[model samples]
Each structure stands twice: as structure tokens, then as C-alpha cells.
Target chain A: MTPRPQQEPTCHGEDYAPFERALLNDYQHELPLVPRPFAAIGEQLGVSEQAVLEALQRFREQGVLSRVGATLKPGAVGAATLAAMGIPERDLEQVAAIVSARPEVNHNYEREHELNLWFVAMAADDAALRAALTAIENETGYPLLDLRLVCDYHLDLGFDIQWTSANETDA
Target chain B: MDVSERDRRLIGALQAGLPLVRRPYAVIGEAVDMSESEVLRRIAALRDAGVIRRFGVIVRHHELGYRANAMMVWAVPEHQVDSLGERVAESPQVTLCYRRRPAPPQWPYNLYCMVHGRDRETVLAVRDELVARHGLEGMEHRVLFSGRRFKQRGARYLAPKQEAIGREANHGRA
Candidate 1:
């Protein structure tokens, strides 16, 4: 593989070493399934296996990498829904905490809109997913809007973090 | 393809993450009481079955400096949704594109795509480009920028036991 030209480190208040950039960009998908996966990654990046392992550990500690694991297809094993609720501005934080506390609510975010608190709840099945939504409604005292998925158009292969220089103007 | 009891246990064990080590599969095998080769075979079988969509590093985009995250929703006509969805998914700017049932009266937009950039302007620019290129201007749409991510983690699967363990360790947020 040809070495990428060393572009100027252009990021929004974040500086990633070249090795970190490679790990973030190249190895997001197609990780070798072997006894010594890190060794395989080391061979590709031309570094020792130990170096790869230590870098991954540091990335975990710094919250840069979520994990090196499987991203199961949505509804592959269970049911999930994108649920939202409108909370009074004063109680947004409190209501968010209540919603986020649920183990089934994997993603909870505050968006800019009337129905601000949005989250994705996954359960063992459709019945369990509905139960989780109902419980959230009861706990938060706010009506929950359950938006079930109709179709998925993209296969999530992870993001490409190597931004071109054209995107640097906004930075 | 039917899943065996052992496969379910293996999926439950892997839902959280693979242990970072020289022999992570061996470590997992010990927990699930399977040999290292058995564990590898089961994982491969699961992947082949499309149960595992992706297996690799999961990065936190916000921390990586793609901070301007916007969720764009459009109310496309029913006849055009299928083709338009495929087209929208082709744009490099759109990371996630999907269709969800729209709540009527209050919410009528169905098509959704997410764009992340270094700043809010960049994200909006991408959205505008898509709108113009796709002739989506006449369609009613809304751009919801994500704020204050209270919680984000890997999708917990299989058993409630795995979820219970995940609840204790849900500190990373973007």
C-alpha cells in the first residue's frame, strides 16, 4: 500500500498521531478474525503487535474508540425503535437522565426541536420493545413518540474520518 | 439458519465488546466455556449468517472532531421514496440514511439522513447540496442538530444479563 501523503493535521481542536489516524480510518472494518488479530493489524501497519494492542488500550482510555467488536444488524436478533419525547426546558436534563438510565436505551440524545429527547431502545422482541417505551412514558410523565423503522438504506461500515483539505475552510 | 443455545451465549458475550488482548477469543471462550477454536467457528458462522453486520473498531465521531452532527428529515412522496433513498445513501456526506414511519399531523417527514462535519455550516452546506441535487426543495423537511448526547453505547443483545452488565459501564458519551 502506498503511504498517504502527510497532509497537515486539520481537525477541530483534536490532534491525532499518524498511527492513530490509520487505525481510525483504515481498520474501522474488515478486522482479521484470527487468534492474534492485533498481530495481523501490526503487520499491515508495519509495527509490533504489542504496539497495536497498547494503542487500542490508550484509545479506549481516551474515549476515542468505543470498542473493537461486532455491530449487529438492527432487528437482527431483537426489536428496536427510535423514540422521542417533548420535555419542558426546565426538566430536559432530569427527564433525559430518567430515559438514559434504562439499560435498553442504548442511544439518548437531546436534539433541537419541540420533541427534543430522542433515543433508540432495543429489546429481546417487539413486545419487550413496546414495554420499554411504555415504561419510559410512565416514568417521565411525557408522551413518547415511537417511530419504528420502515426501511434501512445503508450498510453501516463505519465513518471515513480522513477529511480532505476542502473541508478545512469551515474549521 | 437456526441458532443453537451455545451460539446465543456467544452472541451475548460478544455484544459488549471483545476483550483487548493477544488472545481475546481465548479469554471469551473461557467465560463461555468453549474452546478457542469453537469460539472462532461460532463467530464465523454468525458472521456468515448476517447476524453480525460489522466486526471492527468503533470510533467516537465527536471526539474525532466531526462535531457538527445534523439529522435531516424529508417528506418524500411514496412513489419516489425507494429510489430516492438509494440515491441519498450514495452521497459520501450522508453517513446514515433510512426510512422510518412518520407521525402524522405533528411529524410528517419520513426519510432521514445524518451528516457530520467539523462545523454547523459545513453540515448545513452538505444538506443544501443534497436538497438542490435531488430537487428536494419543495418537500417539507427539518434539520435536527444533535445536542448533549446523554448516552451512547454498543447495542446490547441476546440476554437481559448482558444488558445488566452494560448498564454498570455506560460512561462513554459523545
Candidate 2:
């Protein structure tokens, strides 16, 4: 694993307007799935598909847009599992290497606390997801706090939810 | 930059359904009253705009017996967060890894990650190992698993034809 940079550019301050946030949050739904989807989106917004393209491109660069692809449900076609672990501040960098090295895990992030490292594993089946998780724990020695979703509601964590219009009369 | 009505219509069709045919573009064209080649060009344009990320299948997890799933949040030391963030992302079980800015005193954790699993036991087992290996015994964390799935849909964004919403006005309640 590479060494952690002394610091990362915080995704704060005036990163975007409420419009971009709303757009990022709901951009996927706006995407036209037709042959010429881009033009279709343009038609809806009264903007050229080119504008939508440019805006989305800018969003991607800003980290507000994770990806525009289909966010298919997990464990559907193949398999997936939720896993987490507490990483001591000192050893986090080293442990992250072990966790991220697995081919099954897709997304990972950092949070505050002892169980610092969190990630997910997708596989062809439940067994594979488990085996992979077990292997990760065994190798890393960090316990995984795996929480399986019995039910999901509005699981779409749209980053656009952050959008708050300045025009809101209350504000 | 501005988008047009035709583009919205096109996205609506695809979000509704990616025509399952040899020439899906041609089928979409027929529905919206456009030529297949024209549909294809428009789609390319949307791809450039980042509106349509990918043309892929929408899958269901429970149907395949992945009955359980959860969002696992972890607190890694600020220094080690990034490296660890990348490592956990490599796991297939882990999806949607990110480092959200946590709120004040109560949540000092600078790191947050997620994982999906078939059941609780499986998730716990995986969690334990991560704790031990990452040497995360000293931090605080939480696991907010999804209790129910209320609404999940393909892109519901359709720039209204009549109302012109400024960039800031666009939003959906989660």
C-alpha cells in the first residue's frame, strides 16, 4: 500500500450550488437510457445534451458523482456482504492495504472511531463472500463487524440529498 | 449549459427500460419517433454529459439469496484513513466506500466504509477479522443496517418540460 498523504483536499467549502447537488442526487434518474440518451436528457432540461455532459463531467471531477452507471442491487446476480473493522489510528494505513487488496471489495471509506475500516465484498455466492471476509479478518487480525441488511428503504444514498436551495423562503 | 426536451424523453425511455433487442437503439428510436442512428448519437452525447453512466442490467440481491445487507461505518485514524480506505474498497463484498465528514465531539471518526452480506453471522465474522487485523481495537464505530427498502428506482430525473428549475432547485427527498 502506498503511504497516506499528509492530508487530502477536504470536500468542503463552496464545492457546488444546490442545483449541482440536486442534479448529482437525481442525475441517474434523469439519464436517458435510449440510443441517444444524452440528447434526451437535454430535451428534458431545455439544455443541450452537451450541457448535461459538461455538468456531469464537472461533478465527477469533484467527487460528488461516484459513477453514473447502473447501481445494481447487491447479492442479486452474484453475491455481496457488508463488513467493517476497528483500526487503531497507528496501524490503519497498513491494515487498509490488506483490506483493499481483495478483488471482491468494491467501495471503501474512512470514518471516526476504533472500528475505523469499513468495506463490502461482492461474490458469485454467499459462500464466496464469507470466505473472502474470513480470509480478510484472518490475515488482518482485525475483527469485522459485518451487518447484513434484512430490509432496505431508500438505500439510494444520493449525494444530491445535500442540496439545499438558497431560494428557500425559510432560509 | 442547457439540456433539451428530447434528451429528457430519451433518458426516460431508457430508465424505464433498455429495449431488449438486437438494436435497442432502433427500438428506443421507434418509441420516441426518431431514427435508430439518431438515438445512438443522442445516447453517445448523454454518455459524454455523465447523465447515463452505463448501459447495464438492473439486478436484485434477495432473488439470489443475498438476503442480508448492512452499512458498516468505521473510524480510522486520520493519518491511516486514506490508505485503509483504498484497501477496503478492493473487496467485492464492500461497495460504496467513502470518507464522509463526521459531525463534532460525538463522532470523531474521519473514516466511513460499507459492506453487504447474506446474513448477520456472516457479517459479524467478517467484522471481527477486520478489527483484529487492522488493529482497530482502539476506535469507535457503528453499523446502521438497512431495515427495509422502501423505494428504489432507476433514474427518476426528468427535467420538467414546462417548469424551468434553476440548478439549485433540483432535488428528491432521498
Best by lDDT: 1
* Model 1 per-residue lDDT tens digits across residues B1-174: 666767767777777777777887777776678988988888888888977777889988787677889899999988888789989998998988999998987888889999988889999999989999988989999999999999998887555875543332222211
For each candidate, the DockQ is 0.61, 0.04
- Candidate 1: regions farther than 4 A off: A1-14, A163-171, B1-4, B164-174
True contacts kept of each: 0.81, 0.06
Error of 2 at A85 (Å): 1.7
Which candidate tops TM-score?
1
lDDT of 2 by residue, A37-121 (tens): 5466557656666665565555434334443444433323345555657777787777777777776665555544455566766
Q: Could you give the C-alpha RMSD of every candidate to the true structure, in order shown?
A: 5.2, 17.6
How many angstroms is residue A6 displaced in model 1 relative to the true structure, after the best TM-score fit? Answer: 25
Best by DockQ: 1
lDDT of 2 at B69: 60
